[model samples]
Target: MNAAPSVRAVIARHCRELLADPLLHGDPTLRDIAAQCHQPLRVLLVGNVSTGKSTLLNALIAGPLAATAFEETTSSVTWYHGPEPADPVLPDPGHRSVTTDFPLAGRVMLGDSPGLNTLSDNPRETLRMLGGSDLTGAAAAFVCVLVGGRVDQWAEGLEELAAFSAGPFDLVGNIVAVMAKVDEVDEAVEDIERRVSGDTTATFRFAAVNQLMAAAARTGAVDDRIVATLDRLRTLPVMHGRSAPAWDRLAEEVGTALPPGHLKALEQVVGAPAWLPALVAATAGMTTTGAVAEQFERMSRIRSLEAVLSDLADDSDLFTSTAAVLRLRRLAARLKPRPAALVRARLADLTATMHTSGLHRRAAARLVRHTDVGSGLTEHERAAAQALLRWPDAGADGGGTSDRATAAEVDVGAVLARWTAYEADPFRDSRSREVAALVIETARHRLRTTTRQEES
Candidate 1:
């Protein structure tokens, strides 16, 4: 009766079958990579063009990560993830490097991508990038930030958000609207809050008081007004007044709005039972997974385009073929990832088919593309990709247990046991030290590896 457990059982069965194969067992790295590919959580930032998506990103990281301005910014999707910064922040896989120390929180990974409006020569490419990013995993939640502007400007964005929320990915509810740049608004913050609260269609639970106060505080401009605003935000009765709304609520709202097959992939990322309804709702209007596959294929094309652009930018000599240059710029302007709405809709369709037919291998196969195998991957990319393709069949039946499921079920008692052991003999077993060393080493290796690839 519990859809999550039922679906998970099916996934586990398939994984077991795959792991039993000798070819898969021979490569442990591939096995591990495949395991990680089974599910991943994605958090997407949704807003209108010129909204402070990038600014919020910078604020979250507490450093200048993505480019931001008062005008339309964020030309492409930028992803940020774990291992916390020890000294200075660095971009994953490729792009520019940073040198500021920032603390990290593991609750969620953040993605800042191009917004809906465009002055870019390649708007299609931008959309493609957004879609590609969506396929990477389930959108755990959406941060919908709105700047002070006519409410109508947000209509399209709200529609898009609503569509994304409709998909399976939002098993628990995934939309959180934020009224950003509140300081610039002429009305009192309370009035704005009241107005937002009154709006039933797209009312926000959380609002960011203009960071003007936070910014000023950093510079020692501590005023009573700033303190008051912060206090009000901290005490606001957003999202049913309970300390914090469960993550599932956010996941559900977004999942219900997205395209079908897209949301299932997203649902996998978010994890749990709440996703079933969202998945079912998402598939209500779709007939097949063709649309979902098309979006992923489109993303691959965009990636290829980005590769071409990077090559051309690095060396104009690379473009000996006239067709290549034209193709390069043509795709560049259309680089945004696919919309959550589209992905949600597609996912819903796929899930509906799966539920009816008792699991469709074709649909399962199609969902595989959403897995992220890391960027600028070398030998590992090919290996990771292969493992990802075979992951659905790599569980207990195949001779390996499901670490994810097991990890997900660790008892609180066991956690307490481990904590007690650590406290009793801090360095007796030194397992914690080993884990720390491994993490540090892995982070160092990742940084070096990316740097070398860029240099190459």
Candidate 2:
């Protein structure tokens, strides 16, 4: 079988066909979407004051391109893309654009906005990028929301920002909540994940990251001087807390080996005195710079954050498609009766035929990613749902999709029944019911496909 056309290609084809219909030819909204659908997967990093949003952006790009400081340094919206601008002709003076070389530059566009809930005009600048501006629609396809020290306060701000950008579709799928500066807090990463996931007010997935260390690891901040200093410090006793005196003692013990000004620099690189001991322990026998950087990378937990971001990025096309369809619907609702009917019919046909099993499963997974959304689901029911969404073609035993195409005949009927009932329940929130509806469709399709395979 031939490969399916990309989501953008499909949308472009439909746009051509619909524009020929004369009714949607000059529609402003349709024209805007046609122009913007080609934009790269736009990911915006947003948070309250000093949540390490800039630091995280620097880490992601593997450079210190974004300015980082203890205070609010990012005053304006800075957009980073590869050498080529996603939309060069667009006139949006509110943002500062930076073109650079980065791994994901060609595939994704990264935006770093000013912190929200600040004393100055920072919040307004950020709000504009989040779709409060008069120029265009929402700037980002997905938002990486950062939460630091005070979770409740940051979450409150996030809730308000989420409300402002709210659309007909639930924005939960378009969000990824990041608990930044996890090392600064006393709570374990797992505990932090559980705590954030338990918050019913937020519906996005969660990740715990140490942005400083992650940047250090990615940017090669751990040099030979730092490694030698760590090696010298390792000769002495292990330090306990992050108190100033303990660090002073360690510096004094190393004496002439660690110079007066170098001690402060070492502290700056390693983040905290507590991390010195852990780094010494992590690189007990290591001597090379690469070895030390690898250890620091592992301790940074940046990989976990990258994985979460990668999952969202992989579904960029689907998210863009969904947004475009929603825009078309909203536009259709505003048109005259005859024009609106034509647009609606074309949209309905495109949506019904455009989505594939993989896209459908991904959409379903996003809906139920946080377990709270599927609270009423049984353990077995949830497992089956995971299997279907994650590895639909794999056997019940579990393996890569390429390894085998064993029919996942387990719990299909039960999953269909339960999710169908959940979708019909009026007491559930619209978002949960929407999730149930997607899962139900996926289950019904899977059951039919499995039966056909069995017969063959």
Number of the predicted model whose lDDT against the real structure is largest: 2
Candidate 1 per-residue C-alpha lDDT over 120-203 given as tens digits, one digit per residue, 9 for 90 to 100: 642343344233332222233456667772354664665565444333221112345566665445555557656664554442
Look at candidate 2 and give me any clashing residue pairs: none
Give the per-residue lDDT digits (tens) of candidate 2, residues 1-456.
Answer: 123455545665666667767776755556556654566666778877788889988888889899989898999877787777644323245667777777677656778878886789777877665653332243535455565434565566566655544343454545667877766676667787777766547555567877787788778887887777777777775453443235677767777976566666567766656456667777888898788878877887878867665555655655566666656666677779988888788777775773444555555555665446677777666656655564442321113234222235457788788877777777988767766777777777777877898999
Superposed by TM-score, candidate 2 places the C-alpha of residue 119 at a distance from the truth, in angstroms, of 4.9
RMSD of every candidate to native, in Å, equals 24.6, 5.3
User: How well does candidate 1 match the true structure in TM-score terms?
Assistant: 0.38
On the 0 to 100 scale, the lDDT of residue 72 in model 1 is: 70
Which stretches in model 1 have alpha-carbon errors above 4 Å? Answer: 1-40, 84-104, 121-126, 129-138, 149-156, 169-172, 202-206, 212-456
